[model samples]
Target: MSEKEAETPGKRTRPGPRKVTPKYLENAALFYLQRFATSAANLRRVLMRKVERSARFHGTDPAEGAQWVDALIARFVASQLLDDALYAESRAQSLRRRGASGRTIALSLRQKGVEGEIIDTAMAAADEAEEKPELAAAARLARKRRLGPWRAAEGRREARERDLAALARAGFSYDVALAVIDAEGPADLEGEGSL
Candidate 1:
């Protein structure tokens, strides 16, 4: 197209790049950010979706969508709206309170994208604050399942093996389960039991 045609109103043949409106982006970011503390990755995904959807509806470019996510995250960090370390700690503590083992808590946090070191550190902190429950906790769990503290002089070796196996499957250490089994005797609802 000639310069004269380009300058003429409605004569241009090409569409220029569109500018992403700052106000629209700001509103989109605030909309989701208000829901709760969110991770950078999750925020990005949500923003990307919203941008794409809006762009389609309004004849806007999808690339403009990325700007809002970065803007939102920077604001969140500056305002202390998002902190992975704090998130990890809170999640770790919550899991522990529900009777989850240290290993379980660590793995769950890791699955949520927490770094291994952070998970380990949080778990260590939790351990100090909440010492491991005595073998009794494990025993109580075993007993609840009717696995038992095996009788000292009661059933066949096979019955004893079954009790030992059950305890091990419950995630209790061999030592904890055995000690409890020895003290309480294996369950034998039908009189056939183990020590």
Candidate 2:
């Protein structure tokens, strides 16, 4: 039998013996944040999960680990290393740039544990900078997917209905979708109101 298969249930797969110290947890948090953008709650969840896993392996009290996780998160927040507002703003801008609609951006930030007020502020900022975020996002999507005006003239006629439905499903309003689909060029999309 392979070594893994021969191992007893008590000797299962794990990341070796790890001492779950406060410093270790802090290092873990820093490493995670460095590699990925995450909200405060999400970071807490990740650290807590690590604590639970370590407790299970080492037969230690999870309560102590929980306290360490809380302390570390508090410190990170106080030091300005973990700002939910900044994270939300960055995430919203990324979503908008990727052609996501306003509704989609809000829902995504909510899923990431951002508050509604923060989401509204970020989206408002994006709106002010772009002058009609949803409309611009719709146009970007059309251009990227080669839908609407981006589609060849002969194919545009055939793809009109499908393109409209695609935009609707992507959280765009019918009016914006129709306008983008009927736009003759990029300037047309820019001049049209989002409504």
Candidate 3:
């Protein structure tokens, strides 16, 4: 029988008389964390997966096997190997840079297990960093989608209203939607009192 297989079941894994080295487990966790930053919750879940597999191999109860994994998490957290706040902040910033709106980014963070107050704060910070795209990008998307070009010649008011409605449906806030849609709209329909 293998050395590990010869161990008695009555002994606790931690500080036990056997050669219990968590070096491999520690290396596995550090390697995973090195390649990518992870939320504390996510790291714990990963450790939990390893614990379950170890339990299956030893015929031990999952809870008994998980003590080591829990210890791993405690070590990692104490060493600052996992930080949920930093993870949430970085993720929100990345999504914002990719053009996600503040509201959308907040929802994404919440789904990632980020707390509501932290998510709200992160999104607020992202908004401060975001420079509204001068409506150019929104206009370009409208042009590509062909949702615009207010037909003022066909009667101004109806065309302006339609353009406004289309931009609203495209996820832009009222101010941004109006600015971009009107930027490409017929001047007569958008600004002048004309038929």
Candidate 4:
């Protein structure tokens, strides 16, 4: 093999990211959107990372790439292909079902680049969709993790404090955690016509 093509032990060479252009950014954005839901700010960050990589490898002007990103984001928002509110609401609901606390959900949405106002709205919508959302979420978490009342009677006493701590770390309030941990059985929580 030629010296240039020769491989170092335990190392493999791969091509750098493609050069950034308006069309390239648009295509990348569309491809990304098709595969995952994202907020506009998150999408901007993703596109900008590509621009930075291209700037490094191809000497592309980052300022020009950023302008293209701004225009692309604006177009996507106009087309309703990128909706932060919708993304936040859907993500919040999914997380709630998996036992995420309200605070956890809000923090998660923020990390995804959703605005605080939009996060609040999404959280409110999630709460409206369920009665006692926090309680339900805590119960779901207890059941999934086999904590609290879900544990076998023989072990429940010994594991009570640990179970409460788990719920606490999962973002449940003391009252909610205590309620779930002190329940008689799963039926007590789920039989109230809420899951």
Ranking by lDDT: 4, 2, 3, 1
Off by over 4 Å in 1: 1-38, 42-62, 133-195
Residues 70-118, candidate 2, lDDT per residue (tens digit)? 8988999999889989998998888888788998999998988889999
What is the C-alpha lDDT profile of model 4 across 119-186, one tens digit per residue? 99999998886778999999998989999888999999999999999999999999999999999999
TM-score of 3: 0.56
On lDDT, the leading prediction is 4
TM-scores, all candidates, are 0.51, 0.85, 0.56, 0.92
Clashes of 1: 10
Q: Report the alpha-carbon TM-score of model 2 versus the true structure.
A: 0.85
Q: List the residue pairs that clash in candidate 2.
A: none
lDDT of each: 0.60, 0.86, 0.61, 0.92
Question: For candidate 1, what is the TM-score?
Answer: 0.51
Error of 4 at 106 (Å): 0.2
User: Cα deviation of 26 in candidate 3 (Å)?
Assistant: 1.9
lDDT of candidate 3 vs native? 0.61
Q: Which of 2 and 3 is the better model by lDDT?
A: 2
RMSD of 2: 3.8
Which window of ten consecutive residues has the lowest lDDT sum in model 3?
186-195
Q: Which candidate is the best by TM-score?
A: 4
**Cα lDDT tens digits for candidate 1, 1-195:** 677886887864655333446576666667766875545555666667767766766777676557656776678767877666777777766655544455566666766566787777777766555334424345545545555543334553547677767767655677766776665344422132111
